[model samples]
Target chain A: MKLAIMGVGAVGRSVVDLAPDYGHVVTAVADSSSAAVDPSGIDVDAVFDRKERGGVVGSGDPEDALDAEYDVLVEATPTTLGDAEPGFSHVRAALERDRHAVLANKGPVAERYGDLMALERESEGTVQFEAAVGGAIPILSTIADFGPSQISAARGVLNGTANFVLSRMAAEGLGYEHVLAEAQDLGVAEADPAFDVDGTDAALKFVILSNVLSQGERVYSLEDATVEGIRDIPASALDLAAEDGRTVRLIGEATADGVRVGPRLVPQHDALAVSGTRNIVQFETVNAGQLHLSGRGAGGPETATAILSDVGRLE
Target chain B: MKLAIMGVGAVGRSVVDLAPDYGHVVTAVADSSSAAVDPSGIDVDAVFDRKERGGVVGSGDPEDALDAEYDVLVEATPTTLGDAEPGFSHVRAALERDRHAVLANKGPVAERYGDLMALERESEGTVQFEAAVGGAIPILSTIADFGPSQISAARGVLNGTANFVLSRMAAEGLGYEHVLAEAQDLGVAEADPAFDVDGTDAALKFVILSNVLSQGERVYSLEDATVEGIRDIPASALDLAAEDGRTVRLIGEATADGVRVGPRLVPQHDALAVSGTRNIVQFETVNAGQLHLSGRGAGGPETATAILSDVGRLE
Candidate 1:
């Protein structure tokens, strides 16, 4: 498969590295500033080498990659709220041009699921976004297999940064600020971690999952979700919860009632009580009972694996 | 879609009840003693009314249903070892006729994966057996999304009966025999539970999952796996393991080295440490890291949902 990648960040770079093993080639590569386009295939290794030496991926504008000759457009840019521009526009452009869109960016799907799916119906190509939510856990695909009506509810620990902080606070009896500092130092939390620490990251993921579980019958934006972060969780609360064999986790859940994200008490032995940076999604199906999926929720290579798998699905 | 059900057992009965909701019709149905054939569609409600009175599903020979016209064949018979016959023959017959085979029986898959897949290659129809392992957990389909080569290993707690027995023993500090007896009384285990207690069930599931993870590049049968039962586990052992913040689980694992099934120590909070009749399958993908899937491993409705989902895939 021929590919055009927008946003030469961690996920995009990893996709370029791993695409060949999955029988895929990047025809164009783009960063925020520039892009390299080729009708045949771009030299991925050379591009990586150039970027490693602190150079731009290409000399052309970023939009050049979007217009390149390709069968699929990989949208891996950092997510933004509101209109979810750039990534949303890139995905729309690809679909309009009759090229499949495999997204690592969550913005478009979480915000404009109905519009994107509607566009897919009219376009010759389809859209896939496994990397938009649980990285490599195949959450969306599992829900797709069961269909929306069969799924009663969906819940999970989606944001790794928040989970890491909560797990650390419980395990080490550390304060939230201390753990946040440690997490940032460890590169688990970003410098500006409000998106994760304040629960927006998990809320965004839940919104996307909710859209899937509802089959677009419902649309759950971040504003529609009731969000809460782990910033105020005290050590005393953890101690009290542990007495009952329970622990606090920042859980994101979506049911017929609505989508919610907040610190919830989970049994210490529950699958959703995953520690560190791991993530889990549980779907309550009427017939299938409860299905739990867990894995690394975020990472460059891991997210790239999901993107590649989506491309493979096109086959 | 038109369907021929080859077993009028629990799963088949539930499929009859639920198929209409998924836009499927039972064209034919059969039991070991009798069969029903119709080119149009069978009267599912009437078949259920007859079966409720302890009569065969149909009056014709069982072979009659196998040779009938249908777009897909649903083989939901009880599994048997060695040749895995009857179920194997049913699947083979359907594949030969270019009809899709959706199996709830594990025998044909665990014992003769290669032969069945080879037949599928030659036939126009495909074979799907999500119910063969993990009931409705969608383990095989999840692995298929990542492809075989991307998976490094797969480990899980896959047998409901054994897990139920073990969990009861640990919770109540009861002996295995006592727990097994209680489970039997509760209809959780069969009267003759060798397959469930002696680890053959979990081993069979792992074998099937291994074949799926390897994508036909590797074949694992019940004979090739190392199996052990949970009958000898003492209550004291459970107590001892719990002291180390761990619990013993009947874990089935397949890696590059080999496939094995036995009682192994797992962290009490580990996702695979699910209690009772629940099951979990974790795939260690090279790029995705570790992916965990958990759900009820058995039950008529749960297993039937898997069969229905597989049939949906035929579309």
Candidate 2:
């Protein structure tokens, strides 16, 4: 399959790295970073002729890559919201050009699931976002056909950066300052980790999942889900959760009509406690019952693996 | 799709009962029971020859049903080891005639995954048996394209009948016989109730999952997985689990070389403790970490729903 990645960020580079294994030909690559785009790339089928119109890499020169005839469009840029110039616009451009978008970007779908799905419906294609939510867990594919009408409630730890901080504070008896410093040192924390730490990242993901599982085009509000960041909880709360055989993690609970996202005191023996690194998302259904799904939840290779899994399906 | 369920037992009858909603043409129904082969005449698209030969009834003869033209065949009879007398032979006959199979019977796949897979591969078709193990849950399908490098250990409450009896004892503080009697009265525990109460049923299921996940021709042995029934632990053990905030439920664990099948004291907040009626299977993988998968594990309409879910590509 001929594929193009919108950026050379964490997830974007990971897809480029895994392209060879999955039989994907990276004919074109684009990123706002000047180093990411060069005349003579290290290894490339071809480089694009930058369209001299806008700042967004893919959004500006979507037509330059169109002539090359790529099959799958992978949008893995930074997640942002609103009508401003964001990765969402890049995704919209890709979808407009008859390319099926496999989104690792959250802003586009979370803010505009209706519009994106309408584009897919019109084009007779799919805008698969399994990588966007659960990393490589493949939760979306599982819910579509296998878990239809079976899922009752969806919940779990989504933000890895926050989860690590909480786990550290709980296990090592450290304060938020010490844990946050450690997270930043390890590159686990973003330069500005507000999206992940503030629970907005998790909330956006919850909204995407809710839109797919339930009907009605109305998007889910972060307020509907009782979302609480782990930043406020004291180290003592972690000890209490452990005393009750549970662990403190950023958990998101989505019901049919509403959702609740917050730092939870989940019991340890449950699958949520065992989830390490990024996150674990669980969906409990009436017919199929409870499912504890765990994975990397974030990272380059893991996210890359998630994107490529669907890249071959563009045909 | 024109589908035919060979066995008119619990699962088969459930499929037949749900035929109207799923758009199925029950061209034939057969079993060895008197009701299955009765002269009042079976109601369907067409009734084939009728003459009881064994303890179960089917198209007068299993051979005759295989010969009849059908889009798909759901082989949902009782499990028989070694001889491959009925279910195995029936599945083979269907394959020879190039009919797609949605297997609910474990006899053939558990014993002949390699041979049947070879046949299916040769014929360019698909064989789905999600119901053969975890009833309604799509654990098999999840593992089909699993992201985990390898499954480390999968352990959970795999039996509903046994769990119910165990849960009853825990809730009411009753003994085995008293709970067994109650279970029998509730119609979940069969009159004899040996296959379910003993570790054999769960053992068979573990073997099927082990073979399915691993890419080897090897089959699992009873010794590979330690099969201890609920009878092994006294009802008092439930107190220990409760004191520690846990629940005792029968578990089937899958490891690298073999599997471990036994009842476990899963925690209250754990997905396994929440696992009720029929069966629930959980997979612990290296890549995705711990995944708790729950479903009906057993039952008719639920199992039939599983077969119907795969009917889209039955042919």
Candidate 3:
């Protein structure tokens, strides 16, 4: 498939680097400021080299990539809150032209699913965003295969940054701030980690899950979520929970009722009590009982593989 | 799709009962000694009532259901080893007539995958056997979505009976015989649990996984697997593992190299250490890192849900 990628950050760059391995060609690549468009394929190494040296990806405007010849549009731009701008517009332009759009950006899906689906209904193109929720885990496709109604509820640790801090606090008796600082130093947490540490990141993933589970019956946004983070969890709390054979994890749940994210105590040896940055989601299936999926919740290459998987699923 | 179930066992009964909920009909159902065939949907309740009253399912021969009208043939018979008999022939009958085959029987898949695929290739129908592996966990479908070649390796606790024994031994500090007896009393383990406790059950599932992961590059069977069971695991070993923050599970692994099933020690808090009858499978992907899927590994309703999911995926 011919691809047009928007955003030259970690995920987009990784997608450009790996697309060829999946039998796809990048016809266009872009960042917020610039783009490189070709009818054939972009030179991946040269593009990254130029970006590393503090130059634009190419000479054309960023918008040019959206209009470039492509079979699928990979929306890898950073996630936004309300409007889901530029990313939403980019997806709209692709769908308006009847081209598939695979998303790494969570903004459009989590914030404006109704509008997005409305666009999809009017066009021949399809939209897939397996990368938006749990990176590298085939969560969405599994839900699709089972049919959303088959699932009763979904709950999980969807954020790596928050989990790392909580688990570190439990393992080393360290405070949240200490672990946050360590995570940032290790590049596991961003400079501005509010989205992750404050529960919005995990909540957004669950919100998207709720939308999928609801199957157009209702739409959920950040406002509909009851979110609580691990910012206030102290080392002593982990100690208390550990004494009872339990530990705290930032758990996000999505059901027919609503979406909620908070620090919940799970059994110490429970599948949900994964250590380090590993994430796990447990699904309550109607006839199948409970199902759990776990893996790296976030990473550039990991998220890219999800995006590529989404692209591969596009008809 | 119209489904003809070729067994009146637990899984087959559940499939018949739940077929209508999934918008499918059971046109035929058969047991070892009797069969019920109808051009229209079968009266499931009457069939069960007759079976419960010590009578045959209907007035037809068991072979008659094999030739019954249906869009998909559901092979839910007992799993046999050599030749994968009757079940293999049932699937062949379906595919030869250009009808899809959804299997709950592990025999045709684990013992004769190549033969099954060869039949599928020549016919216009497809074959799916999600229930033949990890019951309701969606393991096979997840592997299919990712493309088997994209996965590096797979390892997990594939048998619930063995898992029940091992986890009981670990939790209650009981010997293998005691736990096996308790499991049998509770109906968690079959009266004759040789296939499970001796590792043949898990080995067959892993062999099937190896076959799928190889993507026809190679075929694996029970003989190819190095098998070990939980009978040798004593309470003392569980105590030793617990001292080191680890636990023992009947772990089955499948990779390009080979298939292996044995009792292994894993971190107590690891995803693979799921308790009770819960089963978990971990996939090491080339780019996505480690991915784990866990759920009820075996049960009548659970396995039936997997069969239904496969039926839903049929073209």
Scored by TM-score, the top model is: 3
lDDT of 3 by residue, B25-71 (tens): 88999998899988889988889898999778987899999899999
| Residue lDDT tens for model 1, A1-315 | 999999888899899889989998789999888888988889877777777786788778889998899999999999988889889899999999999999989898888777889899999999999999988788888888888889999998999999999999889888889999999999999999999999999999999888878776777687788999988889889989999999999999989988899999998877788989999998999877888888888999999999998999997
Clashing residue pairs found in predicted model 3: none
DockQ of the two-chain complex in candidate 2: 0.28
Please give the distance, in angstroms, between residue B274's alpha carbon in candidate 2 and its true position after superposition.
6.8
TM-score of each: 0.97, 0.77, 0.98
Select the stronger candidate by DockQ from 1 and 3: 1
User: Tens-digit lDDT track for model 3 on A1-315?
Assistant: 999999978899889888888999999999999999998998887877887787899888999998899999999999999999989999999999999999989999999999999999999999999999899888999899888999999998999999999989998999999999999999989998899999999999999999999999999999999999889988899999999999999999998779999999998877788788888888999898888888988888999999988887884
> Candidate 1 on B1-315: residue-level lDDT in tens?
899998888898888888988998788999888887878888877777777786877778999988998989999999999899899999989999999999999998999988888999999999999999999888888878888889889898999999999888877889888999999999999999999999999999989888887777778789999999998899999999988998889999988877799999998777788999999888888877888888888999999999998999998
Any runs in candidate 1 off by more than 4 Å, and if so which?
Answer: none
- Top lDDT hit: 3
lDDT of each: 0.89, 0.68, 0.91
Local error of candidate 2 at B153, Å? 6.4
Interface RMSD list for the candidates: 0.9, 3.6, 0.9
Docking class of 1: high
The whole-model C-alpha lDDT of candidate 1 against the native structure comes to 0.89
